[model samples]
Target: MHSRSERELGSGFPAVTTPLHALTLRAAANSIRAGELSSEAYTRALLERIAATDANVQAWAYLDPEGALAAAREADAERRAGAPVGPLAGIGIGVKDIVATLDQPTQLGSPIYTGARPAYDANCIERLRQAGGFVLGKTVTTEFAFIHPGKTRNPWRAGHTPGGSSSGSAAAVALGQVPAAIGTQTNGSLIRPAAYCGVVAFKPTLDALPFQGVNVFSPTLDTLGVLARSVADCALLASCLADPGGIPGDVEPIGRAPRLALLAAFPWVATSIEQEWAMHAALATLRDSGAVVTPVELAEAWHDAQRVHRMIMLYEGAQQMRDLQAREREQLSAKLNAALDEGREFGDGAYHAALARRDILIAAITEWLAPFDAIVAPPASASAPADLTHTGDPSCCTLWSLLGFPAVSIPIAVADNGLPLGLQLAATAGADERLLAVAQWCEERLAFKGLL
Candidate 1:
């Protein structure tokens, strides 16, 4: 594998350079736009880095070096012409394989459709490109963004699962293979993997980024998000892909300590000792910094979190992929087929009841969160588990995903085993702007450090 020192970045228009792979998406774009970095050179540097490291990491589903360079070179030409550039101009982002792209196959990480290629770009892809970015490639995802884990290995430690189903997106960003990548979460898919991979992941409120052209696992629960190195970098991407005109600007200028609730309250879910330590350490840091942190209760009202999330996921997922099963039953994973069978057996009345309870829970949670700016918790039950066949437990993420609320995973500490431990902060539904601000404040206080 090539060391970081061997890879270098060059200047834009003329000739400039840095360790392009290490920079955040927003920072790289600024460098490129200012003629201090060439988009093509930067893109090439990453592709080379990925080529050197991807054999072990396996973070990509579809990579087109030629296509990426062509777009980057075109961007350089546009910049040289003194043309106006978008905020993301010259930056490259990895689209989760589930998100369709015009040029790459949208492999859902299932053997049933190994080479499925959609003819059109997902709605967000078009918006992303229009805002001055190009698709670097498709990152790996768990089959159908469901329970099945993908082949992506945790970049920080080998033989450990990177949390899924947004496995590759988080691993790519953490490995410095790409500045940022998009991922989807039905439950903990985005946040858990990012926490495990030691990167920043932001799952904005439901429908913040349209789901059109992307495969649906559970329409109500699934939401697209970005995994990057830092909160501000995530903000840069969120400003473009999040609900148009809804994203907040400059989360840095917050005036006071954010009112946050420490939600260590899931009776149904238990945290490992390592997880508890990480949470306490993070809470101490935040408390020391003048933020008001208080323990909050959640299980009393939503005691059936995991069960309800699974029910909805199975119900919707089964219908969404019914055709795939009908045509390619033999090709599907045994675990997936079993889940599909369970989904097929879920009663329609139970599904409706789950939806009803979802609404009720959202209302209750909204009221409870009226005072605090955001709720804080551990990203998962523990850091990435040693097992690769099973993605780590996602119980911590189920509540927020169930409510369609915005959640961000910020790496705050390290585990005894040398893996990352993260803090999960969630905001009320549609309160994403404030949520970003709160996350920024917490990020600043925590000052997360990664392997890169």
Candidate 2:
């Protein structure tokens, strides 16, 4: 953590002597707009913090302090000159390497595009800038947003995987290196990392945000998501990206406790003893808060959801990366190549069947969600595992990704081993705003403050 330099406290906005990088996205923006803090100073503080701590976390893939500082200076100048300011003005955000950025190189966590820099900003990045947020750097990601792990390590526990794809984004936010960051989820890329790294991860309803410049990995399930320290920060990013005009000025109350359904276990698997205890504790907290918690499960019709999800992901992923496999087979990881091979072998008929089966399950889950504000489940079977080679299993996240529903993972507790545990809350597709509202309510009630 970096300390703020001695400076005169401005008139209205009080000067912040504490570390500036620890503030949430909304708070930083508010402070910057009030002239209490300079965006350049804020960004510089974060850059210094990154310099200090990133060596241990290894979360960043590409960083350009000069470019980031320049952008922050412009924001400060614009604010001082009485120019129109967006809600996210001066807020710092980290961009996942898989997402295209005009400034940072998008390496896709592989040497295939080691120095590839896109000419146009990804739609998400474009809107983030328009909202006055500046990209602090590009965070590391899994190879092609798949199971391949990156160099990023869990900030809470060293030598453990921070989970995939969104590894850097989640680690950066959890360690207070950045207030918020953009992450993409195809198969738990966003939620898994958030769960393992102990941060808030939000994957809105499919297509609710932008993915125009993101690398395609199962278009049916691909989603642009975010990670931050708090639910309000996630909501702020979601609101700004969905409709900059509709961004809430602050974290507003949802007015009532959400009627949530507690799913104790996946239909195909069971939770570990520690996971069970953590989950039950979360449910108990909600019940004590006067919220209705119901137990539910998907019947035989959904028994194959996880299997079918993999079918579709593999089929679509293989088709998407066909050209790359044909030309650069050596560059691809064995794991990824094996997946692609399986996908190619999966018949077109099977792929279509899987898609149809997925649609049926979506309808079933939608009906299940109709009677509740949201559904609560475990984000993973355990906390960040001790191994760095494997980025944990994706079974817990497979069904949600297949459904393309809005999902939020909030860190609710810690395991006996000291790794962080996340509670997964999801709503029916297109219920993103309500989901965020309910999620914020649950987040406050759980009161499981992070250690980092």
Candidate 3:
């Protein structure tokens, strides 16, 4: 039986009346501060929305309506008591199940780990709670944050995929179940899902946020990121989670115009005709806005990044799940079991060599991006969501993730099928603030010109 408070929380709030449902963490905090809305009220509304739509989308793994409302009420009481509120005060955040939570079951999208709960919240979740955020629920993730798809479906079209690993986080944000959600990426989990679902996603430089308590898939490549409605929203959530002060001063605006390097060819993955047109259209918009765009060919070394990512992932994944494989081999999904089998073949020498090569590739990519503010490229092979059995290719995102570069996916165009297309922009390693500033500037310009 559910608690009366929980049932009340789920049923008490009214539906959102407006069509535009882009609620930012900053905006929610501001509204709370201004007394325009109560934290409890806002959280209740989001819970109601999730109750209405999440059944079909299957975006949540575990929802705690009672806990969320209790947290919201606590935040409101803090404000009434004249306590200072953080930037994310009163906002509801969906935690990826791969990231542990003391209050909810952390299943990591695996049946073998069913009903598992950790004693401590993940580092990022703890930070969000400290900043006065309400944990709305746990979002669905692929099995062990690998290739095994979850039950989540795209909100735009029911049968297609919403992308994986971070599937539910992307779908919830896209369908307005929650304003923003936490996601992780070892390969293309974050950016690929964001692109497929038509939302803004940001993958900060590697190790930007601490990953303590989160389930490890690939230690070196795993990164925490966020999905939201706008670039500014993504930045704000990142800032709160990371608590980086004063927005680094190096992010300079492109005074006259910007120079963008466009990758015309990718050896590992080929763009479809629709994707090609989308890329060209986005490039044309940038050029028409008085920017210089040039087609650049990547070095042959980049062609091997996908394979390198796979090797490192399999090696590390096998190590992470060794205990599980030993204890619950039959309970594991076929995709996960296959990955473990493949990982067992690689020797330590091959793994170390792959790491060394990754560093070299990062240097090469950084040098290539030195002359430009950012690189403009297609985010995925297709403009819209594909079949639910597999997440779209992360090949477009693998090199950038391996290099530890800051990457952002901006929703720029809609495909003929009425689904969204994303334009990805990447910057040099540790230049995330600069990359975001440029992205915000470009997003605004494009939106004004009706190109976004």
Candidate 4:
């Protein structure tokens, strides 16, 4: 096994000459647009990196080097011909396996959908392509984007979990296999993995990015998110996916230090020694940076937020996948089958009640958060767990997901075990732009170097 320092320098393998794959998404795009770098060269570099390192990391579910090269050539051709190019022109992005891609099979990390290809691109994929980005390949997801583990191993250490079900997306971005990747979060799928893998993850306000054609787990809580090396990269990708008007410019500037609320308590979850220490260090950093960090507690209405979120997820997930439950129960993993069985026990009244409770909590939380720029908390119970049999806890992410709030996970410190510790910042619904701006601000203050 390679040392952590070597792993930080791209992949666990020796660094390649040129190392074009190490460029940030924004930098790569700008260089390509300026004719300083060819799309083909950039894509080829990333493909080479993936080839050298993926045997152990196993970040990709599918990779099409030939297809990616062809797309890159076309992008270069269009730019040379002076044809209109989109904002993400020439960029290669990894798509989570659950998102439908007409060109690649989306197996949903399950045997039931083995080799299944969608007839059309998911709306997010369509937007990405329309912006001149090409699909590098699909990254692995947990079975049906649920609790099952995927083949991916954390880039930081081979044995530790790379939090899922956005397992491969976070790992790939962290290792520079792809500059940025898209992941989804019905619960902690996006945030936890990014935290574990030492990358930035942005879960935009609910439906901020279209979800059409993405395999549905729970329409109520499912949200499309982006994982990338930095907050700016995430913002650029999100802007393209959310609005084709191109990346937003001349935006409002945050004129003062952000008012941040520290989430002093996470219900039903115990903090690891590493996490507690990391939080202490982060809070001191923020205070030293002239930002106001105040201790805040969840309101009474949010005490049962996790339970409510699970009830809604299971109830809706079962309904969405009822056909599969009936026809392919035997093929499904035992963990998933159990979840389905439990979901079926909830009747219409119970499901509706959960939704109602969710609405009340959302209202209360939104009002409570109205005074702050964003609320800060640990992204997970700890750094990635030391086993592959399970993903890390989702307690830190459940309430925000349930309320459809916008959240971002930014690495604040590294744990003693060489894993990244991320601090999560969540804003009220429809506060995505503000949240991103705030996250970037905090990121600068933290000065997190990630694995690099």
Candidate 5:
């Protein structure tokens, strides 16, 4: 028998028919502001879409349709009253379950806090509210945002994995359940999932967005990010969350073509042939579009990035989960416990040494990469795996996460299996705005038409 997704997506995975739910974040906000569409109408369409698709997708941890509609009505009322509406005035955003939401539960994808509700909104959520966006629901996350996979499945094809730990956020956006969603990355949580799901993921420099109300696994490496259908959408959502003044429209143009440094394959990782072909195709397209594409090799000092990143992540993660481990050992997964065990074996001296080495390499690589606008590589080793037992390997993302660089993943091609492929563009730390601009420029040249 044919599967459900094969039926829903169709044999060709045809261009998504233009429905109200298929509107982009920018288009939705503009329509609501222009009185051409009501927030309630837009929200109802999304709710119906979620209801129709989420049975197989399972992208949400918690959803309250009634509450979401109520908030949508409030936004419409404000616009009717002639009050100034924010840039994201009527947008519905899906928050990762780990982020605190006063109105919904932040379950952390663990049984230990099954029904736990936060008393206040996370800093990012509060900012999103100020920008006139409402939280549609909480998306599922892996246990403590660690290695364990969640219930989310790839939207392109059924029975395939969506890379974690930001599994649900990426899938929900790709499925048109929400225009944009909040996610975080310590290693590859944001980029890998976005790549696997055929969406845009932007992980800004470390601490670009605050982590105050988000559950912490590795305090040093944890960074808040956003997932959306397009590069401009990611820029909008991320800028809204990071800005203290709550500017929701911060997407800027790159006045000229960008210079990109291409690494055909990531170091010491097994990349699929499909992924390599996609990268080459993307580079050729960019070159034809008058952009500079130069091939570059990794510096010798950057050889141990994955190992060092693991050391720091596990050590800090172990400390962060210490109390929970002591109190509810049985409630945690064997995979998490195993990681924690490895982390505990890392003494303070070893952890500090890793940190010291990271500092030196950061400076070395940053200078080496200073000449280029971005370092381009494949975001993940391959398309989403055939089954959902585990998320894909994250070795390609380790170096950028370790150095606290700003990165964006742009969907470029679809694999032979009909799964999407993406290329990662990373820039120096503190160059977030410039990185977004370059990504936008590259995105225009690539002209990726994503599956809805």
Candidate 6:
């Protein structure tokens, strides 16, 4: 079992050579824009690093070294041609296997579709390409992006599991294998892994980014998210993925002291003792720093969020993969197969009722969020668990996903055992920009105080 300790807290892996790797992303882009560094140089460095470190990490499901270099060369040529470069020009991004790419295999992390490759790139991948981001390769994902564990181990502690189904993407980012990667969440895929790996993860409102061509787990709860080292980095990437006119500029830092709502009881769930303390420590830090941290009651309906999320997920999972089950029943994971079976037991009326309840919950939570700039809580029940047999609980993420709210996980403290702990912040629906702005403020404050 992984335990958090002061020494383990905030100890991230070394930086990678790829422009998409956080440390290199800005510097590489700055150099290339100034004609001081060629895209080839950056790409080469990244490819070499991946070759050196990825074998044991198993963060990648597919890697196309030649294709990556070719793309980088093209980017360099475009720069020499004096063409306008996109915001992410020459950046190398790792894609979650569930997010299809035309140039790389899309395995969806399932033995059932062991050799499956989609003909077209997923919508997010298409957008990234259009933005001048080169696909480094497809990162590993849990089977069908479900609970079945992937091979990724947390960079902070090798024997521990990197949270899934976005395991590879989070691990890749945490290890400096990639600057940023695209991940999807049905339950805790994005936030949990990001927390476990001690990196920044942002799950924007559901449908905030295009989802076409991506493998679906739960249509109602599924969300596209980004994993990065910093909130600013996430904001920058998010801007690129969003529609040109729709994307806002750098959020002007909020001038007034930020008002934050702390979910006192967190609905029906009870937090672990360690998690409770971590939150208390975080809240204490924020309060001492002048941020208004007020206690607020979440909507009563949020108590059923987990069940509602599961009902939607199981129903959608069964519907989406019914054909696959017919042809490859034996290939599905036992856990997923059981889920499908359970889903089949629910009548359409019951499923529809759950959907209705979800909508009501979203509305109530949205209303509850009116007064606070953001809501803060523990990212998970505890630090990454010792057992890799099961991915940590998604309960921490259930409320936010159900409400279609934008949520960000920030590494706040480490436990006594050398594992990292994360603090979660969620904003109202459609207030993604504002949420990010508040996060930036919190991040700056934390950094200034040496609390990160």
Best by TM-score: 2
Per lDDT, what order, best first? 5, 4, 2, 1, 3, 6
How far off is residue 154 in model 2, in Å? 0.5
Model 6 per-residue lDDT at 450: 14
Count of clashes, each model: 6, 0, 0, 0, 0, 11
lDDT per residue for candidate 3 within 27-104, as digits (tens), equals 667767776567887787777777877787899989889898898898999989988877787788988999888888
lDDT of 4 by residue, 32-132 (tens): 88776778878888888898788888999889899999999999999999987787878999999999999999999998788999899999999898889
Write the residue-wise lDDT of candidate 2 on 1-452 in tens digits: 22463222456544445567677788778777877778887888788888878888899999999999999998888888888889898676899998888988999999989999899898888888888887889999999999988899999887899998899999999988898899999888888899998899999888888889999989999999888899998888877777553434355677988899988788766678888898899889889998899998767767899889899999999999999999999999999999999999999999999999888899988987899989988898888888989898877887889999989999988888888898999999988777888889988888776744
Clashing pairs in 3: none
TM-score of each: 0.95, 0.96, 0.92, 0.94, 0.95, 0.91
Candidate 1's residue-wise lDDT over 1-452, tens digit each? 33333333342233223466877787788877777677887898899889878898899988889999999999999989988898888888998988988878998888766888889999989889888898999998988887778888999887899989999999999988999888898989999998999999999999888889888878879898888998888888877886668775346556788889998746767888988888888789888989998888775657876688889989998998888888998888888899998999999999999888888888988998999989998888888988988888888899899999999999988887999988899989888878888888888888667977
lDDT of 6 by residue, 138-253 (tens): 89899988898877777677778888989999888877777788999988889988888888898998888888888887888889988887887787777778777454535568
After superposing candidate 5, which stretches have Cα over 4 Å from the reference?
A: 1-17, 245-248
Q: How accurate is candidate 4 locally (lDDT)?
A: 0.87
Q: List the residue pairs that clash in candidate 2.
A: none
Give the poorly placed runs of model 2, Cα more than 4 Å off. 5-17, 243-251
TM-score of 2: 0.96
How does each model score on lDDT?
0.85, 0.86, 0.80, 0.87, 0.88, 0.79
Q: Weakest 10 consecutive residues, lDDT, candidate 3?
A: 1-10
lDDT of 3: 0.80
